[model samples]
Target: MTEHAATGPVTRSMAVPLGAFAAGAVVAVLLGVFGRVHDPTLSGTTDLGFRTVIEMKVVVSTVIGVLVVLQLVGGLWLYGVLGRRVPSWLGTAHRISGAVALLLTVFVGYSCLWALGLEVGTLHNGEKVPVRAVVHGVLGCAVFGAVVVKLVAVRSRRAPGWFLPVAGGMLFTLLMVVVLTSAAWYVATDGWPSRAGY
Candidate 1:
């Protein structure tokens, strides 16, 4: 029984969640790049517009990169630790990684809201920027909300370990939505640079 448990169902059961995490990470990286499409080019040009805009872009990119790396490390560690059974050290690393990832995500969401140009006051083309900005903002907030729920569950010793994974999945979906909708918006407007105010 011990050998079977070690080699069979235990190992196989871990695969599903691990695969989900891998897929989510891939989606996050791709979507993160799209989220920062308007950011300064690699050379870091800042003279073309308000400093706030460029600063916000840099903040968003930095936060996204940090969160992405944290997530990848956490996901990989989680798969290994959960699969082989948690060790003392990896468990601590997992907790630390999770906390850092959540913190970065919260900031990333703030940056994302502005990056989408949906801040409290902003006029774009005589009308507020597209509602898609709101959608992206709300979704980003939801991801942060999920992390809060998961943290509460952890401290309280909750039964199900569903909140974190659910949060991850929601974040992934939101990223995709933001990417596609923003692309569509850009296309419809004939590009931001070509507009009169731009």
Candidate 2:
């Protein structure tokens, strides 16, 4: 009876986000599998004119990092963490930043996943890649999944008040991991303007 009491109330509020997140998780899992299964030797480059796809990705990811920082601060402000009164312009700015960041993230992911997928061992793209590349791939996939969860949580009327904040924070954390692994690592090892000619 106690177990039933705990689990039986699977209300619409709970079910919608749960189901939405599960679907998003599936998308992430499929992306990870694609990264591993795809031919790493196959090469493609972005027309954006960076000498390599990785450079383009690093540039995009860097922008995304800045955008997420904005999102975090704005989120805190909106939640009254920074102040009692929220700015009228802040909510719109937050939404815009989030949307742009998500789009840029997708662009980077698509470019990387298509051109290189996941690299293993030494000398994949004329450069040595470490295990972190694989880890980055996994985290990259999770970001998209988290994005879906956040989007659903945002739109769900029945979701608890705390649910959206928790979801947004989690998504931001996941994205930072992706940025650190790919963008920060690339800049540190290769320099700010990547030798690949960003």
Candidate 3:
């Protein structure tokens, strides 16, 4: 009976969610570990016209945070958490916004990884990165991991109905934390750059 217990319907049904959790954990750990070990590029040029790469990352992170809020609302609407009748257009909009938010986050993540690695005690603008930035780096990696869970759960027919909503909420929460720790904190403390009114 104990042997079959592992193969019970509830357990079988939970495999996808379990797989998702493993995938997220692996991705986050790999990225964070790699960042800590890699030799950062340390220099680059951007024609996108931001006053600094830091500013660019901050702005994009903020935008990603805003889009995450929309995602939470859309997910609720689609799941009938908000009410019964979801608009047909909501799904498409949700997909588009989610894609954009993901791309933006990837851009920021790539920039951070390539230019600065995990920061830790690394000097930036003549000072070591604060603890919040280190927290942001780790959490930022976790956001992409959660995104992996959400994406797989969203696409997998075998995934339990609750998986999608839970994955989405997790992603939303991680992103909000990542944004708060980095972009929002920067804004609250330092404000915008003199030339980066954007």
Candidate number achieving the greatest TM-score relative to the actual structure: 3
Q: Candidate 1's residue-wise lDDT over 80-110, tens digit each? A: 7445554667657766765665564555454
lDDT tens digits by residue: candidate 2, 1-198: 697697676455677767877978998998888987887642454636666677778888999999999999999999888976897998999999989998998888888777777665566468777778877878888888898889988888777777788889889999999899989999999887544442
| RMSD to the hidden true structure, all candidates | 12.1, 6.4, 5.8
Candidate 2 runs further than 4 Å off: 1-12, 40-47, 120-129, 194-198
Model 1 — which ten-residue stretch has the worst lDDT?
39-48
Name the lDDT value of residue 136 in candidate 1.
55
Pick out the ten consecutive residues of candidate 2 with the lowest summed lDDT: 40-49
TM-score, prediction 1: 0.44
Output the lDDT of residue 27, model 3. Answer: 95
Q: What is the TM-score of each candidate against the true structure?
A: 0.44, 0.83, 0.85
Tell me the tens digit of each residue's lDDT in model 3 across 93-164.
Answer: 999999999998888888888777887885757887788988888888898799899989987877887898
TM-score of 3: 0.85
Count steric clashes of candidate 2.
Answer: 0
Clashing pairs in 3: none
Give candidate 1's error at residue 155 in angstroms.
2.8
List per-prediction Cα lDDT, in the order shown: 0.48, 0.83, 0.85
